[model samples]
Target: MEPVMPKDPEVHSAPAAVEMSEAAAANEEDPAHPETMAFCPTGWLPHGHRCFKLVSSDRWGSVEENCAALDGDLAGAETMDDYNDLHTLAQFFGHTYYWIGGFYFQGVWRWIDGSRFIYNNWHSQNSASSYPCIALRGAGGWVNTNCGYSYPAICVKRAC
Candidate 1:
């Protein structure tokens, strides 16, 4: 299904992680304390206040599906610092390019999860046409692409 466009493109903030901590704290095998539960899910790696999971795929939809299944959305780097961190992580995974959450809809670039479109790392060639999705190059640049094209994805969500 195509993503729903918000009537007004307000910035989206990640849900607070305290809720996740509370949930995990309820599980006996899940650390038993809020402080200890701050880590990301078992297989996911942590950076700052978020957890990111690299899901390998050659298809954008598959990557979106995987991220949704984990109760997260595609990683949207709203700051240069975030882009740097995600870029570093993607490099470690040996990916030359990886899907992020931004996409063009109705001529506007908006994050899939509705986060603020506060920053950009676009390559000079990225601004050309109607490609509706974005991928981050390993060198920390972004390019637009046809949404149907395949690429690995970085799923991101609140840590813990």
Candidate 2:
């Protein structure tokens, strides 16, 4: 199924309901620590306290499973910085759309890593039941689409 795009492509503002955590805010303000780079494997980008990498395209479930095999899960964006970093990384790797860790479950959207799903930049709020998986658009904004669709994905693990 084709992902739905917002009427105004430039409307990519995140909802103001969520506040960035103190730790995340601090990390965003500070540059990556030198030691953090050593923790990330070659090809993985080190940011804040985590390492992120873009994986090959596949169905959401398969992509998630592939991430798990690498000792991580699909990436989650707890802050606007985190979201933008993920988007930038995917774009850098030339992927127009890629899966993240967001999913609608039991009426609530949750990150696969169990982080709170507070921050969002949805292009349009589609019915969660029909489009349960979340993918990030390289141009900007998020899209809700079927989990079965194949797309590249970002995987994140702690840099420690």
Candidate 3:
């Protein structure tokens, strides 16, 4: 079945625009802090001091590896804002189903990046052992599915 679009107000209300710093606009890299990025990289969306991107379809594991290569991990929704932002990003990109950082591990749900799994937007309480990975439905809410299933994925990393 096709997922439904979210009715959440926050999802509809556009997120605040993030402006690039002067250094970032100049494309200057800081020699003293090579790790610091003034802005998100090309093709990435900047929001609240973080950068996010959607990658092409792949299995959950493969998608995570792809995120790692970009110096990030599968995206996680630790708060309502995070969830709304991710949902909006997917909707904007015209994706129906996309992988997030959630997974069933050690008999508990956890974000791949080791973030606390406190907040959630679960579509249902059904979490069968066979469905170990979490995917965000562009329509709304999160779903547990087989890890081997292929889907586009959202990757996120801190923006310095």
Clash total of candidate 3: 2
**Local accuracy by lDDT, each model:** 0.67, 0.72, 0.75
Clashes of 2: 0
lDDT for model 1 comes to 0.67
List candidate 3 stretches off by more than 4 Å. 1-38
List the candidates' TM-scores in order: 0.71, 0.75, 0.74
> Which candidate gets the maximum lDDT versus the true structure?
3
Which of 1 and 3 is the better model by lDDT? 3
lDDT of 3 by residue, 1-160 (tens): 5333232333222332333456544545575765544467765666556787777677899989999998998999999988998988787766567889999888888999776589989986444476878889888998888787667788998875
Under the 3 Å rule for N, CA and C atoms, how many clashes does model 1 have?
2
lDDT of 1 by residue, 13-110 (tens): 21212232344333322444344344567666655667777776545666788899999889887888888888887676665677788877666788
Q: What is the lDDT of residue 108 in candidate 1?
A: 75
**lDDT score, candidate 2, position 119:** 88
lDDT of 1 at 72: 89
